[model samples]
Target chain A: MRLRGIAVVWGVLAVAAAAGLFRLKYEVIALEERLATLTHAIEADRRAIHVLRAEWSYFNDPDSLDKRVGAKLDLVPMDPAHIIALDALPFRPKPVGETAGGPARPPRVLNPGSAAPIPVPGQKPATLAEYTVMRTQP
Target chain B: MMPALLRSLVRRSSRRGAFLYPGAEIRDLPGAQGRHPARVRVSVEGQAKAAVEVGRNRLAITAGVFALAFCVIAGRLVDLMALNGGEAEAMAAAMAASDGPVVGAVVARSDIVDRNGVILATNLPTVNLYADTRAILDPEEAARRLVQLFPDMEYGETRDKLASGGHFVYLRRHLTPEQQEAVNLLGQPGLEFEPTERRVYPQGPLAAHVLGATSTDNHGIAGIESSFDRYLLEKAEPLQLSLDVRVQHAVRDVLLKAVDRFHAIAGAALVADVRTGEILALVSLPDYQPEAFSGAPADSRRNRATLGVYEMGSTFKLVNTALGLEVGGYHVTDGFDASHPLRMAGFTIHDDHAQARWLSIEEILVHSSNIGSAKMALAIGGDAQKAFLDRLGLLSPISLELPEVGKPLYPDPWRPINTVTISYGHGVAVTPVHMVNAVMPLVNGGWYRPATLLRQDPEAPPPGHQVVSARTSDTMRSLMRRVVTDGTGRKADVAGYLVGGKTGTAEKNEHGRYRHKALLPSFVAAFPMDDPRYVVLAMLDEPKGIPETHGFAAAGWNAAPTAGAMIARIAPILGVRPRGPETPVAPEVRFATASGDAGRAVH
Candidate 1:
């Protein structure tokens, strides 16, 4: 009876050991596959970066830019006399709103942060709506 | 019956006892039979009990050892999980990070441009091919195919390289796009294309000396490209230089023609905007193509405009006369006796084309009288001369954006003797750039704007320092105009333009002695003097006198004419309208001496 009991215990231990080892093997395989996938993705990214760097150099070539500019714009080559100082520019103001019948009004000096002028009695004031309407008409 | 059966059993036991003892007969061992049977039964029972006890002890020992080992392992696991869990996790993460794929290396490179938004130098992307030998399936076949595609590549070399067990090997660098495509179609495992920056110069050798070139690794090796290397590699915003390609080509073409005509040793030219101190064109002869820099001789790579310093003979007269009038309290009407050569320190200073008459300050400059210039320097004194030259950026290396600048060779003691020789541009040495920069204030209304490689911001006002009085500057402009129209620089005069300039012809110093055969001829000029805008200079090193030059290698013959041609071509490109000859020169000085006779003789 005792011998039989010992044999039974040995059998149970051997089966348990085999099961544990099988599970460990599968876990290792899964991790290895995951590592490989990550490596592949990273390598792809590296190749892309390399291609981009080369393209950058090609586009920046002076001849390339010159050709592109010539093709795209109506640019005439400029000389030193074509360049002038900013101070030398003639000062001119933009024209005011257009209307045939309306009387010419003095140009308004708009202070960036100042409050708008208050309307006085017996004076026709320009309201916000009127201003918007005037601006849309133009 | 029971006794008979017992007796039979006893007889059987007695027989077994007899065999065990080997001496007793069955009939004689009757009592021994019963006792032996009981003893045998007890022995058998005891043996069974011993075996059971041994098995139970062995099971208990195994269980004890197994439980102890399990406890130990569990304790270790707990310790690792609790006490060192964070560290273990960190270590694992570090390992994973290390194992992670490497990203491509990115390099920042510099940018180059012409003054007018023309791209001269730029960094572009290119593909470099590499291979993993270990990943190659058939090295021999791959090598054969590769050699077929690239005839330059040796089959044996490619095979040996592929056979090298290294994980990575560089097959080629800077492969063309078509080459890259061909390599890609091979579909060889472990082959890779790495991105790298390649510097490209679009204008080739047009402005090679000024623009410089970069090495294969995208390092600046020469010229502005090399000098501003750090700024370029930092991927800083594009540097817009003051160089105008149109003017640069004009200057280069004329100088190259002259170089070919004369077979001169070297030549250089510069065009600067006087108003803003902007350099429009700079050309050095014996130029190299930036792309194929290897083919150029070492001497051709040297930038003569900024790096080569020579005694700029009569050109120094411009600075001398300007300083003399400024420091000696002299006016255009101030007259100096030039009837005889001035002797000082055993050296006699005389005019090249001697007037042998008293000359006013303007006449002295017009005639380029060495004696008059030396006397004027003596009046100014040594300390004042030093201070004035230091102010003019002649006492030291010119401060320019480019790194290839030569130091001015001037006397250290600043003695009267040094002053006298320096006044006529004999003892002093300076680059053409220095001479041009020093002369700028004479025309730009007394303000001196330092030369720059950066583009000017139209909205922001340009920065400048006052180098001379506006009145003095106006006076110098008028004097320079006279030099062009009625004096030594008459050959430099441009039609429909009020041009003003000075000519210099100095012998080169060889073996500590001036070589009379070797001359440095230079011309510094500004056009439309009534409204000074640009200062242009042209120089020829060791120029030979040709028949066309009337067998003369003087600045007036070689450098002045070259400058005149450049101005004519570049002025139109720069959009400078040609002024009619009738346009009066500005800020005309009144002569205190009524020397109408002196003027005609001087001319």
Candidate 2:
């Protein structure tokens, strides 16, 4: 009687294990199908993005921009006379009625950022190259 | 007896085992010593009964074992076929993760970008629509539907194609996805979409000649496209050219307006960096849209700047004076007589507006005296002139990154007449690119760098060949500056940039004779003559006399002013700052300190 009881218990365990394995197998099959579908979706999205990038570049073409901007904007090409080298600028002039070294020491000129202004004749900076480095201080 | 018969039958039967059942029950023969006891009586009925019981037990055992084995096998199959399904899913997910985003497909040709990384030519993914004609059950319906979707398609032609019994046929290529979708909606079983690549020029006709065009199969057929076909097809990286779109547009816009204003047959303009040998802007017109390449006229398709050789007229004067000073042992202070036209080998070489007196070499160039240039070339000797021209790469086709290079036309024997005529840019014909390439060395310290369409790193510029002495180059720059300041190229002068160049107005040679009315006027210029950074050339082919040009079609009136406008527009963009008049020119270009009044002496 005891042996029969042990056999019954072993049979029940075996059946339960088989059922678990069967459930796992179906779940795996379902997951694989989902994976295949997801892979396809990602590939499709990637191709779409590629197409969009090409179109974006096409629409932003310079000629098209000129046409689209039209008469609303009165933009024009730059003029060379408007540009001046930094070294070509005229120096700052002295202030009116002020002595050469009155109090501020002429506002520390090697540094235009701190220099007092009374624009000098033929000394005014013509372009950013001169003005950018005129300020000598930290 | 029955037991024996049964055993024998069982042994003889191929389907049954030879061994008899060990558990046989001796039912009728139990302790049988009765009656005939014949060979242990072979009790048939009892033995038969016992054999039947034994057979039943054996069959039960065999069935049980088979059932157990089948159960194990079924369990293993379930584990592998169904239970391990998750493994496949995991593997697939890992594969997808590993692959990440899709790899970029090999483009039929690499994109061509400008110096600043603006797209000029690119590949766009498109679909080619085709059909399996045999698969089309209702050819007429399918063709009608296709025609409706694509208005460009002819109904009868499409119908005939679809009705054909062939296995396959291409209907249309380079269709947009939206068009593909619309075709798909037609529900034709035979219709199919084949993914393909189509080359696109986003800038339209802006850089047409430089970028060139590809064939229907996407192979490069012209311009830089044809030259760099291998690199374009094999490389993944975009090919960066030296062209600057802003400058290119400026050149084209200015040239187009000038061409239209003059009612000229055609026009060409170029901007090249003096130090780098990089061509920033090259415009040839009337240009055609690169996208609609098949319909362009042959004339419009010509890359005149690089491919059309013409008597570059007086622009060659720059080369003449530079060579005279460099190798002919000529002096800036030397005097050349231009009082009368000189006859050289039965050809009269004279100035158009003769400066009727002895003029300095400086004044000779400013006056554009053919006699003075011829005298100078004669002084240099024919051999020296030929060598100089050869060194300038003007005697042969220039090697450049374009398939459409022009072969220079010059007198083969190079007689004294050829020498004298070539002195004033008559006997020799060269492309505008050749003119600029040669003149660049004169203004940029005697270094001759070959012209290129690809961008070069400024920090690591390619080595240049020495073309002239530095002293001669400086003297040449001063002379050229004098041309703009006081001579024929005065109109090309930009106030702040200190522009300097030479002007040329050649009568167009037509049907083996020069047409006085038709002219090829051109100007070659370099800016900030103190330290030349850029060389610009503008040419007008057969421009008619216009009233606004003071009824003059000379280089000074047309080509010089056009160059001036182009320089004014592109100078600031090219980062060349304007210097005030008070600012001294770099010391090198001022080879001579003498100041002069030659305003009327030049003409």
Candidate 3:
């Protein structure tokens, strides 16, 4: 009885090994196929990126850029005189009420430190409210 | 001669001392070991049993060895076939082998790029369609199908090629990827798709002359392409040039406006970094498209900046005055006689923009006085002037990456008259490239770095020989600056930039005689004259005098201002910060004869 039982166990182990081997083989094949597909996809993406970059350069060419939005954008090449460094700007102005000669304790100038930057030529003019800076602080 | 049991019985009997009886009846014995002759002994006794045990042990040992060997072979087979995923390498090799050619087919010869990593010339992957007529059983049917895919292809021609019974015939080349897929979907026999690469210029005609063109077979035929063919064929990294496309665009933009406004036949310009000798922007007008340059006018295909040698008019005065200071050891305060035109060796050395008085060396350049320049050149003589120009890289073809470089034209015999004329910019002819090369040392503290198209590392600048002293360079800078403020190049000054330069308005010598109407006017400008950083050279060919220019086609009216406009636009791009005072106070110049026309620009 013991001998017969051992024979039965050996048969079960052989069957399990065969089943595992079959699964492993298919898994390898599946992984290989996936790898190849991904490689091809990567290659295709690279080619597409190359083409798009070329197109980007063409569109950004100075002639085309000028033709496309040069007028409508209210833009122009920055003149050297206009390209002042930030350091060249006057240090952050003192709270606006202090410079505008308002009363020492004057009604906090309604909106202090809210003054907008002066508009450059060809830019939209600053609104009256944008002219307020230390009015709020005072 | 007995049965098996009988022989065993006989041996046992012999062991029992019964061998004396031959031919005994073995059947009567207890078979060999038990009851039958074939029945083997289950167990033996004494010495007979010992001998039988030894023989049995030998059989078991032999069987064990064979069984172990088979077990080992089975394990190895399982290991290779399935266990540990150790599949046969040959199987994976086969898979990759099927894909190897497909992957290898898409590479190009090489790419060409600008210094900023902008792709100038690149390859686009395409497909070529061919047919094997022998394998194609129904040529008419295939051609009919092909016509639907390619409407441009004539059915008759395609049918003829397919029916020629030849092994291979091209149906189309450079098909788009979408079209390639459409042809593949046809799934017809005898058709093949071959991967091909087509060279394309993304910037179009922007840097066409510098990049050049290639043949259909992908061989370089001109420009940098022809020069680097061997290296390009072996490497995949891009060939990087020193050109800055943004600067290039800026230059082209400014030159186009100048050429159009002045109604000039052609134009050329270049900008170089004085410290490194790197040419940032090189422009030649009437440039051809790199793709189909063969159909363009031959003159448009020429690289005027590097190849067209012009007499260069008064631009040569920059070199002459430098010779006066550095070689002749003349001081900036020294005076030269310009009171009368010097008639030397039959050539009337008269100045069109005449200052009929003894003028200082600095004032001579400011006035653009030909008589003054010729007299100065006379002091230096012929041989010394030639040696000076030779040091400036003007005597021979410029050493550069482009194959289009031209050899400078000068009088070979070194005559005295040639010296006088060459000094005032009439006798010697040089390309705009040579002129730019000559101007660099005058402003960059005397480092005559040859302008190179290959991008250079800023940390390791190329070595150059000094052709002038630092003091002479400094003196030249201030003198040229005065030209912009008080002399013929007044229109060439940009506010706060401290621009300075010399104007050359030379007549073209056509058929061995000078044509006064055919003018080649040019301007060479250096900015922030205190310490010059960039040198810009602009030239216009045969510009007509317009009413806006007051009917004058001189360098001051056209080329000088053109360079001024270029400096204004490009200074900010070249990282030159606008600072300091807008206009500088002019110091008192000795012997400068109170000048007129501070309001009028002259050359």
lDDT tens digits, residue span B189-222, model 2: 9998788899888788999998888898988888
Q: How would you class the docking of model 3?
A: incorrect
**In model 1, what is the error at residue A77, expressed in angstroms?**
13
Give the CAPRI class of candidate 1: incorrect
Instruction: Give me the overall lDDT of model 1.
Output: 0.77
Compared with the true structure, what per-residue lDDT tens digits does model 1 show for residues B525-585?
9987988888999998888989988888888887888888888778878777664322222
Q: Candidate 1: where are CA atoms >4 Å away?
A: A1-138, B1-107, B186-190, B292-295, B581-603
Instruction: Identify the runs in model 3 with alpha carbons over 4 angstroms from their true place.
Output: A1-32, A85-138, B1-106, B134-156, B178-192, B581-603
What TM-score would you give candidate 3 relative to the actual structure?
0.76
Q: How far out, in Å, is residue B584 in model 2?
A: 16
TM-score of each: 0.65, 0.74, 0.76
How much DockQ does model 3 earn?
A: 0.20
lDDT of 3: 0.83
Name the candidate, 1 or 3, with the larger lDDT value: 3
* Chain B alone vs. reference chain B, TM-score for every model: 0.76, 0.80, 0.80
- Candidate 3 per-residue C-alpha lDDT over B1-603 given as tens digits, one digit per residue, 9 for 90 to 100: 235455666667567644534534434453445644433434457998989889899999999998999999768757765644345566567667766523432346777888898888877878889998898989999999999999999999999999999888999988888998898898889998888888888888889888888888777888888888776666767789999988888888899999999999999999988898889899999898888877888988899999889999898999999999999999989978999989977767787878799999988899988888888898888999999999999898998798899989888798988998998898899999899989999999998988899999989999988889998899899999999999999988887678889999999998889998999999999887877988999999999999999999999999999999999988988888675523322232111212742211111
Q: In angstroms, how far off is A114's CA in candidate 1? A: 63
> What's the TM for chain B in candidate 3?
0.80
